[model samples]
Target chain A: MSSAYLAAVGEDDSRGGWRPTVDARMVRLESAVEAVLEPHRARLAGADRVTIAPDVHYPFHPSTGVVTDPAVVGAVAAWLDRELGTDLVVVGRSDDRIAFDRTASYLGYDRLAERFDAALVDLADVPTRNEYRAVDGRSVALSVPKPLVESPVIVVPSLRPTEEGTAAGAVRTLGRLVTSGADSSRASVAATQMIDPDLAVLDGTVAYGDDPVATNLLLSGSAPAVDAVATSLLGRDVDADVALSPLLSDGERPVAVENPDGVDLSGVRERLTGGRLPPSDDTHPAVSSAYRLYAAASGDAVPPQLEGR
Target chain B: MLSQFRGRLTDPKPLSIGVLGVGNIGMVHLKSALAMPGVEVLAAADAVPENRDRAERAGVDRTYDDYAALLAAEDLDAAVVALPPFLHAEAVERAAEYGIDVFVEKPLARSTEEADRMLEIAERAGIAVGVDHTLRYQPDMVGVKSAYEDGGVGHVPYASIIRLNDGPLGRPPADTAPPSWPLDPNAVGGGSLLELGVHCFDVLEWLFGELEVRDATMGRTLEIPVEDAATVLLRAPETGTTITLHCGSYQWEELPEVNTRLRLEGITGTITNRDHLPKNFYADAARAALENVASRVGGEPTVFGPTFYLRAHYDALADFCEAIRANEEPPVSGLDGRRSLALAETAYDLAAETVAEDVEVPEVRP
Candidate 1:
């Protein structure tokens, strides 16, 4: 009965994949967002306080399709405030790498918050409640933030692959907001169940496959269901993803899109499949090994960047 | 060994060196010194136990928890001052008291005043002070200079240099905790200008001669305490060239593909650093490795091969060590470091003035 909706907006005529101008991208994003959310508008109208959790783990330039564009969040906020008349909070968490508030500011969420009369909350600063849930037959405990627990949550994650070689979907985006005693996969499942977000809106205006691509589309549905579709689109086997395997039934057919329009789903899958995040270590292991071997032979000091590999 | 050279004695032995604060870049200096011929890495100092562990793994004979202790305990020709900017002054002063020459990492001190005091002490103690301004040592920059000097870009009227990377908060997958001092204004004195712009200032001067800070602007992409991005307009009076230098820590950088671009719009044509860079990083690295191996077989000097960017650090340290051995001023001396700091300070001031001028005044009440 669950279905993910896809809506394409703007022209895609450029030889090497067309990217809409900023104005065109925004207009199209809002149209796509409106179309995707049309099916869930009834539930959205009933919510009082709604919090939008986004893939804002770092202040990576939004144009790279690495992080959710704040413009999309702004458009979503404007529509929610106008149509649903709901109090909104744009939520993220501060980790060791960067503060969520700083990341949001860099991604232009501060102006978005001001323009939409929304609160920019760092989940780390919020009070948390301990919740225990069983994921994959393992007991997982999560210290989920109060704002996310008490509000109607809408997860807006960027279309990208995580370092663990899985789609960083709505569930993982929500999981990143909480403190978990479980491993990443288990933690993501537990947090998603505890939060039970009302909607998952993917910011696929730009997507990071092997590289950034201008997909210029938005898709929305149930958080876990949408993530299942995202998993397939990212060319990942659901059984291979620890988070998706436990959460989604193995026999569940490929999530059928409610409205496909003139979009090329197979083309989208082909372009985004087999994509992975860039290496986050000091240097590649092979390069390090080669450098060390070379250093031994040449009696040259190994560069520190090559050390500790 | 301790009594061999009580203070500045001419011992025919190879230059014995100590590395203080073997963190990321410090480790690079430590390893570079370790690999250089006729130099000994006597000891290394770091506050972090993990860093000391890394230093040991890199073959340092002795390690100290504090740099002051290392300076007090070791017998060495020079020390590499690779501590944070706040500690740079103290580290240099300690080296000075022990009559040990120093090669410090960039942004020589937190400010020009602190650098002046450090340089004065080094001068009084008769110790050489070398600053690791490694841009000049980089092959691409060197190639640009060589081409410019060769009149390949005849009478360049304008030039622009851009250097950007994901600053303290590096790009995802968010591997390590970014050090806090880099973002704190008091701790580091300034942001990208001091951390990265200083390097540009040093390189610009090297390329165009004395540069005059014209108009400037600084921006923070985030609400962090310091500006993460800076753009400065400069005029090189000697070369009669207008230059724009923009540096930021906001861009995401994946290695082997650095985002440093240098372009010269000359009277004849455009000359770019890209023209000299290796077509393929890994291929060039492999070639460098093979050449170094061949050199080893031939009993010739082995250049720091494999990485073009890292080779500069090696060459810079090698130059400093050679300068100390010859009892001469370092090629990139303390004064050169101070000069870059002065230029950055001017840029900051000019940027602040621009901001003030742009501020709108309120209408007078009736």
Candidate 2:
């Protein structure tokens, strides 16, 4: 079983409470995901294989469960197949047995990929480069370049860094995959171990201050830049200790996010490489990287590695 | 030592007047010349046969189709050239050469060159030439001049003359086909400027002394190609005073009642006059208006009036006849006519250059 970890963050509604109610956070997460993804299903028709990463649940916001649940992932895949006329595979990850037992009966694990032209990869541990590359090529038909391990990969930080660092596990894994040439396509196909993925996504909805997977902090507001700026203004380093930790070496100081409040993310999703995600499950790292790439390509910024990435 | 050189009117002798052309204006002169003291309607000529018949019906004794035959006749003492603009020079020259005193209609010739040649011939021949700039003779104009001279209009700061009328006496309708002669630019020289503006130009000069136009602007407002309206500004080179005139084919319905206003601004006060009234009327009106307003405000009226009016046309005509009889120069001689025409021509030229510039008539120095 190949599984994926997905993290979601949302705002806490409770006053003078240690944590926000899970039911309220879940509704907000569901609404934001639906708002972001429902309108663009027709535009994301190429993908065939997909995995549902379990949401990194925290006490700050309950909406974070959407990101951690495989049921929601399967539902989104089914929706993409029906609406966009594309096949998608779905897999789930969860620490709780109740969720898995209840969702497994309704989820067609066998026909999840074949009936909808999709597949489910059940994993017991973190994803390796071979696993990701095989699934990406065979399912999504992505021609990732060989030597992607040596290619410059940028990492964007979410607003809140996880206390335990498990919340941004996807960013670290993506960075490793690129460095190992798992997502690359240009190398001799026979010699190439697997294609390296050059991009990563980090969710900062219910971020953790000390240990993200355990101590949840609702920091959802505007775009990723807004949260990053707010956290920086609060004296928290985003790149080194938050979602951007994967791109930093030891003792590497994080740079401040510029004009985070003034950044207009109105059409950010359309200009992004991947389709837009709902606010509950939005990949802040992905949005920021895409923004930096666009800015650099347009000669608006100096030729330096973008901050946070 | 003013000698009374008035001709004797002992008996009403038939004035031997030769009509050069029986056109509308010519016919008027023909009729008027015949009615004058000691006048005889001896012979008449017209290029058109219809005009000759009209002249005959109007009591011309003999009618000739060709003007040359009429000029050749030795019986006439005076001759009137009522031909189009182009024929004026030749007719006037031929009449002068024949030892006949000539009354040439307005616009002496089609060009300044032709006018100069005709005047020269008349001068050399010692024959009297009277330009029918007839507005100078009108009753209202005589009054305006007298009022201006008597200080009735005080210093005469502004003098405006407006002579707007319907189409010229016998002008054909535009839709009925253009006139063969008047429409011909070569024959007519220019349009309303040469034809009718000549009258206003002469009248202004006569009233205000020699007028030097500082600037002028002209425009065409009618269907015809001629200039229908002209605004002129005049300046007295010595006095440094100014006058303006706006004359045109405007006010078609008010053709018969031409309006003129001469305003004078003096060190003491101001005076204004309209139409043709005796100078006394203007002086009286001015003094009364000023005094009545002053007295009502508890101030005394200082102005008084017994104003005079100038009746100069007959006197002007008598001067011409006396010049002919005494073989002396007329007061307003051919040079005077030429000078006025030259000023008028210059005005037209300036008007063409600055269509909106104010036209000022040049003043004559004493």
Candidate 3:
């Protein structure tokens, strides 16, 4: 029986600010990370080299809960280095929008990787292999980075909604890391199935709902099972989630979430049910048109900004 | 039309204008020139075909992929130098060869040295140089100036100004690539200090006489190649006022409102730019629009009436045009622009010193 393990990070008593320092948060996250990683500790420790994949899509401020915090990754690194003494590598890909190294540096991953004696790798520059897997009864081929498949992997994804109003979960984060001709849903499903990651850690320290909600919890399990749990926490329908439905336990929606902290799941679901990224366009067209008409009728001037975008 | 160049017998009446670089700010000047009563936008130029197409859509007669081509072909009284700071000197030099005056977008030039060289060429060509330092012309700043002059705040002490925005790398879900020039110190000269602090310097100098940099600091929030944040301590000897100015490109700004705060603390009370802003921008804009239509004769309709900050750009260009028509110096001349750059350079020097001072020196082995 697959289960997503949940652990509540202990409260910060020593410091507070707009955000706690990464080191401070890392110290606080140690217990939670240890608790979640306990189940797979032996398997993870035996791996020659472990790769940690994170949602470092861009350097959006982590406080907004859009991207995973470096502190959480730092905490995981500390745990791995201390408990397993395992060699670790943190990975993210560079895209046309921004470079991986640039994103890593901005998110403090460069320093965190160094502090934990882990190598920071841009998967874009790494060797890749074509892997074909069956997802939703169709073949999906993905050019996956070699490091992801050659070693045990742990995916750390933030608790947030995509611009398209879907949970940016473990599977989707890993899915986008590979090159594929398949549609996004199928590609992501295929990527997860092909990689068969050892663990999926969901960073819900500050979960983004209609706005950012301080959930202060971490959940870990198999990629799809953890994503199913995340989907539930985000108030999403598992059967409605085509990419996630195929991976979930035979007809069981997010089988069993073993919450060690007994954190109220209902209250969290209610708060984070429907959330989306900030609107790209700040000003409305109607306002500009109204202002333009008034400017025209009055023979007064409308600033170019007030005129139209 | 080429025969009517300023080198010949060009009429300043209904000033013939060409806009160089149809980027965001260039488009602002282009539209302002198009809408102004005594100005005619004859041509526009940009290296980007899409930008040229945008200018054509905005109703310019001719568009050139190169500004030099526009200057070589158009018989115009003036050209608006709206290109990147790296290209300002060349753009102005090209405009000068045709004996055309110029209204340049600020910082005027990347550095004081570049500004001096550009101004020297304009002087030799006998062309008036106007810089688009629009902060002083903003309504709130104007109101602050009016009240300060009226002794609303009997000042005996301190002032502060802050300007912040999400520069080229806007906030998420940011999907586009930020321009390379803004983050390149070699191209832009400096980061937020050069981009935004100069405007604060210009406005502060307008309010209080000349300013002296007392201390300064620069910060980079991201791993970008430039300082995204800057703070400067300044002393105005003439006004006996000490001021603090902070500006940054690290913020996530939204439209419909801008991040600019100017406050003067005095013996009597504080005078803030916020006090002058309309309580409701839309209502005020609607009211202004309706009024502009109601009174057609002798009633000055606020240009860029609905939006306050952009109105400053329109007014700044309009003032430059008025100065050009009258055969006088621009209100914010190239010299004034250089003065702001000099202040920024000094702040940079002081900031560098602060960084040096942070380094530990081994005490001599005694």
For each model in turn, which proportion of the native inter-chain contacts is also found?
0.57, 0.00, 0.59
Judged by lDDT relative to the true structure, which candidate is superior, 1 or 2? 1
Best by TM-score: 3
Cα lDDT tens digits, model 1, B1-366, are 011112343446889999998888898888888876668999999999999999999899999999999999999999999999999999999999999999999989989999999999999999999999988888889889999999986899999999999888787777776787888888889999998898999999999999999989999765678998999999999999999999999887888899888999999898889988999998988887787777777653344577778778888988888878878899999999999999999999999998888677989999
Query: Any runs in candidate 2 off by more than 4 Å, and if so which?
Result: A1-309, B1-7, B10-15, B168-180, B259-323, B330-332, B355-366
Per-residue CA lDDT of model 3 for B287-359, tens digit only, reads 7666667666655455666666777888788888878877889888989999999999999999999898867
Q: Encode model 2's per-residue lDDT on A35-82: one tens digit a residue.
A: 334433443445433333223221112222223332234334455555
- Candidate 3 clash pair list: A298-B292, A298-B293, A303-B304
**Tens-place lDDT digits, model 3, residues A203-283:** 988888877787888999888888887788788887888778888867455368888788888888888987777776435
lDDT of each: 0.84, 0.47, 0.84
Docking quality tier of model 1: acceptable
In model 2 chain B, the worst 10-residue window by lDDT is B302-311
Better of 2 and 3 by TM-score: 3
- The TM-score of the first chain in every model comes to 0.92, 0.35, 0.90
**Model 2: per-residue Cα lDDT over B23-87, one tens digit each:** 76666656555434445668889988877887777667889988888888657777777788788
Give model 3's docking category.
medium
- When 1 and 2 are scored with TM-score, the better candidate is 1
Question: Local error of candidate 2 at B64, Å?
Answer: 1.0
